[model samples]
Target chain A: MANLTAALTALPAFLMVSLLLLAAVAYLFRDWERTVAIIAGVYTSGLAFWFWRMDLSQPTQMLLGRPIQLVAPLTVGDFTFQVQTLNAPVIALGLAMGAAAFLLAARASQGHTFVPLGLTLLAGYSALFMAAEGPLAPTLLTPLFLIGLSAVSAFILQAGRVGRVAGPLRLLIPPILAFPFILVATWYIDQIALNPQDNQPAQMAALFIAFGYLLLLAPTPLHSAQTSSAETAPPVALTLATLLYQLAVLYMLFRTISAFPFVVQDAPLASWLEWAGLATAVWGGIAAFGAVHAGRLWGYSALHDWGVILMVLATAGARSLPLALFLLGLRTISMFTAAAGLSVLEQQTGGLSAASLRGAASRLPWNSAAFLLGGLGLVGFPLSAGFPGHWAAFQIVAETDWRQAAVVLIASGGAIFSYIRLARILFGPLANRSLLRERPLSAAMAAAILLISVSLALAPQLLDGPVSYILSAFNG
Target chain B: MEQLFAGLDFFATETGVLIIMAVIGLMILTWDWRVALAGLVVVQTGVAAMGVARTGLPAQWAGVQVAVMLIAAAMLAISAVQTPTSRSLRQAGNWPLRTLAVVLIYLAWRTIDVTIPVPGIAPDMAGLFTWLGLAMLLMLGLSDNPLFSVVALLLWFIPAQVAVAGIVPHPSIFALIGGLELLVTLTASYLILVDRLPAAARRPVMTDVVFPDQEPKDWGVTDDAEEVVDALPLPGFVQDMVDSGRAARRSQPPALPAPNSAAPALPLPPGGSENGETISEQTAAKEQG
Candidate 1:
């Protein structure tokens, strides 16, 4: 165990070394893509298992019962700070995320050159967050995450361009706008210099990060910039990838928020969140009011999903975090399923215009079912994975202010209208030629959607353990 | 009254105003001009809702003022992205949208008063409203497909999150990176949505735009070739970089056929192949630059 911790503590440096090795080899040998992905995934799974195993008893952290170098400093300008490394579980998570990215890269039409790199960065981030001793960890992770997301975004954007609808301007700009915030946040990290003894600054820093991530979850103005680079057939996995980031960001929020309820649970802050959620939901819905594109409709539903989480997280309690985390899983399933169906539809027809896809469902009823199911999830319809989380959120909010709950519900109505409208479009009486030409359904896409929907439906508790485990860190 | 005239006017004092400006600049950079214009309107709304340096009713109606600002923003968004064929219109089309960007910026800055600050949460109302405006602007600007537009608009979250997280080290840094993350996300989304277009199967303006699997034949002749010639040249640095078979050009592709209507506009058969990255597009971009 001690050796494991020692190895794990040195993991960040090891990851950097590995990234170099992979990058060197990846360009020359494309065949290693699958192997890299598998290793990354297994690595993450291992970390996750370790996280569970180590923290099994209480809110305890025993890292292979060993002491690794607590901190290593990097000097930029006058600042000399060592980056902190995290525990096995978080490192595992990085591995897992990387693994997932690896799998996705492999599944993509082109073997993603960026996947291995992204996984390494994500692993580094997880390691920093979970094991690092000082403020530098979060700061380091911030830049690393920015780089990782950008890589993912860039790859996906390239994929989208390759797919068609090239010149996706949306892909490049949002990251540029976000760069300043990162620079500023990094500076703060340097200033705080949180010693290993106290996790307050790091935790609080994360809360702040989460607070910002709430908007990220929704992606309002820079929305086009956010998703302009969607190039795959079923954009679900890609969407899921984004959601995974959101999950991490939200987890950062919940745990941190719990620790600092004074700052987090304030009326003004909560009010801002509430109104923002309402406005975002309503605004996103109105935006989708006459949406013609099926994918666009899905995007609107996504906005609604973010709004739900925003509202739920606005209220502070043990339940809120669990539900918020749970909600993420549901959102993942629902969003991914819908993206898969839409991917199929897009593949069948070339575009997603309303006039063209007048009655697509009548042809591929099963895929349509998946699409509808995803839509249901978006609106938090009963039995859908999206349901329970929203319900829990609403239930909590309603207890305090029914009006707020009503607002959230009204916002949700936009998504429902959208879904119903889509169904109407899919089964419409328009006389235009079938905009959709049938391709044999992709078993992978179908199975993926079915699995997402089924898991969302059957295994609500899959989230329970993780959520509780994360929440335990809150001191609540 | 003393607080109102403290000389640190809302526009001058609030950091979010700058953030709003940054957001607008970024939106213009990424989205179509129409969406960018909507972002401009939100900036105006931020000014109005947040108020001028030291003007307007500084108290008693901050929420309503902000709401009004948001309403204006929403109205502008609807007008800008609304296709010519919609249920009904409270306003005319092209001209109204054309005027929105600069007009809203002027309106917001000239009106609303955000003299008061929300302690512990730096930047005050001006900053707060800017975040809200940024989100609204995106939601409105992305009027192409509600689904797509909404996501694009959600890019506003980056700034909004920045606001809540404060200008402190952790949140600011995280939010900034979040902004970039958003940028990548929106761009990817744009790519994803466009790729979903069935017109893809027909032929590509560039040979490289073809899905590796479906492989678009010789389709994009429309004005692609002509346009390519007129494109701006790539800078020397980029020009030096290697591209596909084609040398980097400083001009646009010549007039190519519309990839959508030129081939299969009606049928959407979603599909593709491996090696999804477009070697040609990158070369084309470099050449066009």
Candidate 2:
């Protein structure tokens, strides 16, 4: 057993390689939905566990009387994949989210490629976080390229049999636009390294980097793809893909700031994040109010919640990341719960349009309730999982500027208002129509999700230990 | 040692410019899917050649780029072939508008005269690339068909890539870019193929009909509603046509079933069918009416 453990520790990049290989296996067994889901779920959970238990401080340890070399960086050819202590928890969070998506796919339908494609994306993300300088630096430019490629892959995965390709196609535009700017920024960064005295290169680098991240962050006008995708793509796939990309981008943002302090000192990056957050949050809410489709409304609500998290991120840069992550953790629960219910609802109803879902609650009561409560959680309504984090964030923002808090509160009302409208339609008169009944296993899954949400709402303290551990990664 | 066949020298020449322009123009102007795809192959080949020359990229890398482009074009062609309903050899609709747009884009590119600051590339080559980029962008904006849009998008990548190569000509970078292009092509092909698939394959057939408990709406005027149609107070010509049609229908026997068939020998729903019309025939007639 000790020898086996040592052999595994001797290969640090083993997890990434295994993830990729497992993804291929999942693709091969995609016809067996249960098998694919099981493989994906177990593999991701295993990865999360590995990251959680990793002791990066120790390079070598005695295992069964043999010295086992345990290092973070794994060199493959010229490229090195390192486990950055600061990014481990974030990676674990992403993996956990992926695991949830996979396990849910066991019961719900997230399309044919959701498991394999999702696992592939996770592998790319892990490689990205663990990458160190070789032929290309892991800093910003190489990741941008990887993101562009990932976006193309995502576009394919999201395009399924659904005829709406517009949303998936829109996702391709931002990365295409961001790449050149970051490429130029990298050149400028190299120039700065050669000539340290001149602030010109740093300024140029800052400007270009800002433009790149602005597009990558995808606030306001650039947010249509996300909303459109939610309406068209499978909910679980959308949740996993969106969360994975957002978390990776968040980490990239922090890493970029750490690498170049002038980004905050010389550039208006802080203001950009703050204003962008405000606009995005407010717009998300207002948009939600008018969304007639259940899927679109769910998307808008998430967008609004994302806005609040962004505001938290803008508060004190790295200092506020833990709070933001806490909110994101709550968001993961809300999204997973809602996606589970929504996927089942879409499957039975054949569509998510408001007219199609008339009196859906009368047929699939448990799933309906799950969808409703989960959506409400996104808007941070009282008695929901998201309420505590949102309320805390609001209080924290109000301490610095009460008006900002008020804006967020007022915007949140828009999603709440939308949810209320959705609730009426769901529970209204049956209208002499019939819908497919929810499966027993599906109901059980939804019940489990509901229990988790209620438990989190009642005992918000359950998140403290994880959040604090994640925060410690950044504290260094 | 003499430097033989130095990079991008051909692209700087007038002949190279004309060939590039002709290929792009053919791609944008042609309505034929086959012809458009042919133009795409030519454009990609030229891009690969130019990148190899300009950046001194390895032959293997250039081969990879060319091979990927060929496969992408083949995928698009296969989809086009599979979709029999796709129009072939038809004159492009609004050709004048497309032509004018193309001309206007080219004029704008020339008028702006903006210098691209890509290192180690000639000025003429840069100008040519800029023009090609703008033309591809225009094509992307104007296209409505997914196949054509994908082709334009792929073409746009060439110039952007050449610029990137000029700045950082790493083999890994080129390989990554090639892989992404292939993935995009695969996705576009899948969408095109699926779009042309039968309706049942796209969405659940159950959603096509109203729930069993809900009554389906009757939009057309039935025999019982003839009076209502007559009372609409339509113009004389229209009313005459309707009356004539009804008279013609009355003169004819039932569209289907024998005059002494088993359909009439059996019990029939009251007022639903006359003569020896089968239930299916009656339903068809009702639908037609």
- The Cα error of candidate 2 at residue A353, in Å, is 1.3
Model 1 spans > 4 angstroms off: A1-9, A15-111, A117-121, A124-148, A160-237, A254-262, A265-267, A286-289, A339-368, A410-414, A420-452, A473-476, B1-289
Give DockQ: model 1. Answer: 0.12
lDDT per residue for candidate 1 within A20-126, as digits (tens), equals 56555554555565565555546545545644455323322335674334343333232233322223433444444445445544433233445444544454354
Clashes of 2: 1
Model 2, range A1-476, lDDT digits (tens) per residue?
87555445553456666777888888888889777897789878977976777676877656567554556467666568766677777778778888999998888778877888887778778777776665655666544555454564555346466344545665666666566666667677778889999998898788877777877887877776678778888888888877877777777777777777787777787778788888988999998988979999998888888888878877864447778978988998998889888988888888888887888888888888888888888889999999998998898778778999999899899889989999899889765376777888889889999999989999999998988877765543
The C-alpha local distance difference test score for the whole of candidate 2 amounts to 0.71
Candidate 2: which docking quality band? Answer: incorrect
